[model samples]
Target: MSLSQSFIIGQYVHRNSIIHRLDPRAKLVIAFLFMLSVMLLNSWLSYVLSAVFVVCVVTISQIPPSYIVRGLKPVWLIVIVTSVFHIFLTQGGQLWLEAGVFSIYEEGVIKAGNIAIRIILLLVMASLLTLTTKLGDLAQAIEDLLKPAKRLGVPTQEFALMISWTIRFIPILLNETDNVMKAQRARGVRFNSGNIVRRLQSFIPIVVPILLLAFQKAESASLAVEARGYSPGMNRTQLRTLAFKKLDYQVLIISIFCFALLLALRK
Candidate 1:
């Protein structure tokens, strides 16, 4: 299944590989550091290095490259649009194309290339995070990390629960949408055989069912939580605690090294 279409609801492939076993906190921090480095990078050489790093991380995770690429396919259009805009609208150096009020420059092309690479790296990093970490683990890690915020009068536990539920429900919602589409197709609803407006109108039936299903699920979940003694202003213990392992320390060290290297290069 295409990563974009797959219900994000399944158990992530459990692996004892380096990427999978690292602490979620470490992974989150490294992701942020990697993104920061990518943003700081301006040269093609740096971008190439970043791409290699991403490839190494992806390989270690042992997930299919097709899944990663497929997830990125949905956003390809946006990337293209942004690239085109930057290539034509960004002003620098000598113009390559000049017509009336429109122009494209060599510098713009370079800028566009850099921007596109940065975006792709960002997507890869995000996909890596999702692929390697289970939704529950991510939630628990977030809650633990945000525990200090509780002293500042924030509902960290409740907020964390909401995030956990949202991530867990994404795949379920996608699956529900797929089922709705299949049923509509079986009922002779031709999704692709109409004008833009007609196609949109056809989606009404599909959307309504999905929304109703989501509402029902939400209601059930709420009741279930209440029955389980879930209270807003009470302290709760976690079943699966997250701990920083040796690999997490190694990852943090590597991130620090990369950040320092990037800063040195920038200098």
Candidate 2:
């Protein structure tokens, strides 16, 4: 599959579901806590529980299971390389294998699995958040959450805008890269075969063009921002003010309850 086909980060799914109806602020907070919980999780049982919980949440979000799974396609490369490093470089417990300079230990294997699962969980939750919420709402939600920091002279609006821009453009950049890849492939350039260095060298054709496109996009965004009289640390109006409703509070309470339940279960 093309990178754009399997990689759906920053894409919003317009669905009328329980999760979609909730305020983005609540969604943001819940996503943050969910990822944090994943990171803190240590045991296999905890991960199994978390994975089940994520599946339930995905169902509730009304996003197709295939979409959720496809989102992990681009992540496999990073996860594989990272897991390899963790398993080979890290050492503890019983030695699983000794191969010259690289030795795999039982603890390293366990740790690598743990970290890979953690990374996947984090990405899944993040993707779910972006999928269920619009970029505008996400940005406004972030600004609302960071409002208190404004008292300390923080440019909360700008910070939120920056994050919004980053998330909003990731998929675009990936699509652009995919287009470049297809173009190169049409010219008989191979990216998936041969030695590591060969594959890296094959990708060099797209780097400069992608960088140029990124710079052009940035310049255009800056020009548009200036045209709109954008200012940092200034009082701004929101299209839709984020206010927690009864349903939002109820979901929050349930999430907290489940978190407590998981904590107790882990203990």
Candidate 3:
């Protein structure tokens, strides 16, 4: 996958829609529930209903469907490989194709289709969350959610900070990779139209520089944090505070209701 496509995975896009305006905590809660409901899905009917709900939410969020689809382009190969595995490796329920010891069953095809849809839904929903919420707000929300674990000596703030840094660095690394690849390409390195081994070899120049850059960036980040007098366990204040509002409550209730309906359908 190109770095441009990889860059979209965790990068946040600013917008002024309902999903963008909701408290990050509320959005996180609903996304968590929605993911659980999607994983629980089994039948075609359940998947159809879930897809409908996802579309409705995406429509309301006001993000272009094309953008969401583009974000998923990088993962299409993995999704296809997973679906193929399910289709061929699964055994039982009246064989559709048989060759020697290998057999493709009727059940396998359906199972593969279901698994592919489930994965796509999961990615789309996650992308929606990242696209609508700011990284700082997401970090704060994660910290708020993990606050209870601090009683057990967990480093909630540090974990939240790590999460925030991770999201922040994704696009940085991707852009760096793109730059490295373009430099290599300029020197007549063929990334495409090569055998698997040759293609892997072509990436060596790109990978080494990326690792060095990553370490350098990490050191710089550490120094910046220390210079700011950041202590591991110290209380930190945010410029913006998160609070739940009427819209958040309404969205939560509706999300929970839909999740319940999905569960009931699955049962």
Q: Stretches of candidate 1 above 4 Å error?
A: 1-11, 99-102, 193-205
lDDT of each: 0.81, 0.89, 0.88
Report the candidate with higher lDDT, 1 versus 2: 2
Task: Assess every candidate by TM-score.
Answer: 0.85, 0.94, 0.95
- Best model per lDDT: 2
What ranking emerges by lDDT with the best candidate at the front?
2, 3, 1
What is the Cα-based lDDT of residue 213 in candidate 2? 89
Candidate 3 per-residue lDDT, tens place, 9-123, comes to: 6777777888999999999999999999999888788899999998998898998888888888878988999989999898779878898977899888988898899889999
Per-candidate alpha-carbon RMSD to the true structure: 2.8, 1.6, 1.6
Off by over 4 Å in 2: 99-102, 265-267
Q: Evaluate candidate 2 by giving its C-alpha RMSD to the native, one decimal.
A: 1.6
State, as a TM-score between 0 and 1, how close model 1 is to the true structure: 0.85
Per-residue lDDT for 1-267 in model 1, tens only? Answer: 433264222336677788998998888788888998988888777777788888888898887787777667767877899999999889999879999998999999988998898888998887688778888788777788888998999998889789879877777777778888889989999887779899889888887899999999899999999998888989888787778777789889987797767656652
Which pairs in model 3 have colliding backbones? none
On a 0 to 100 scale, what is the lDDT of residue 254 in model 3? 91
